[model samples]
Target: MTPSQLRSRIKDENFCKNIISYLENIIKEDLSWINPAFEHLISVSSDMESTIFGSVSNCIEDKENTKHNLSDEDKGEQEYFYSGKM
Candidate 1:
């Protein structure tokens, strides 16, 4: 027997955007979410070392992906923060 079709991810750009916005609102409401939009951030640690960030050309260029970018002059990296944003 052979498969009749291929499985795929959600391709609706607008629908996906709505879902993401909904999720973002949920996290911001009850959780300790942090970012430029939040005031819950702590000061950088004294022992924290500088870091070099890698470029995310794919996500930055992909129109279907969430439209946001988070970067710092020092350390690089979260999605829930994606490791860097988090």
Candidate 2:
């Protein structure tokens, strides 16, 4: 799923809790069958890592390209700044 979808899913407290509970149960049950579980876990983790890193790299590239294309005056604009009120 995309980041937005993931964000929406995470916003639901019950869904998040259920996911945590499910994962905990899986770990508890799989602890005895280390071989198969370890292989599956490693495969899932590697895929996730690749997806996350690719997204991050794309974001960084986009930001850099935007910066290069901006005028000197626009470059000085604050994209992010602290709100003292908070």
lDDT of 1: 0.46
After superposition, the stretches of candidate 1 with alpha carbons farther than 4 Å from their true spots are 1-9, 31-86
44-81: candidate 2 lDDT, tens digit per residue: 99999999999999988998778778776665563432
Quote the positional error of residue 79 for candidate 1 in Å: 50
State each model's C-alpha RMSD to the native.
21.8, 15.5
TM-score of predicted model 1? 0.25
* lDDT of each residue in 1-86, candidate 1, tens digit only: 12332112235677568778988998779543446444423334322322212134555556235344435522243334446544
User: Using Cα atoms with residue i matched to residue i, what is each candidate's TM-score against the true structure?
Assistant: 0.25, 0.46
Predicted structure with the largest lDDT when compared to the true one: 2
Looking at candidate 2, what is the lDDT of residue 57?
A: 100
Kindly report which residue pairs in candidate 1 clash with one another: 77-84, 78-81, 78-82, 78-83, 78-84, 78-85, 78-86, 79-82, 79-83, 81-86
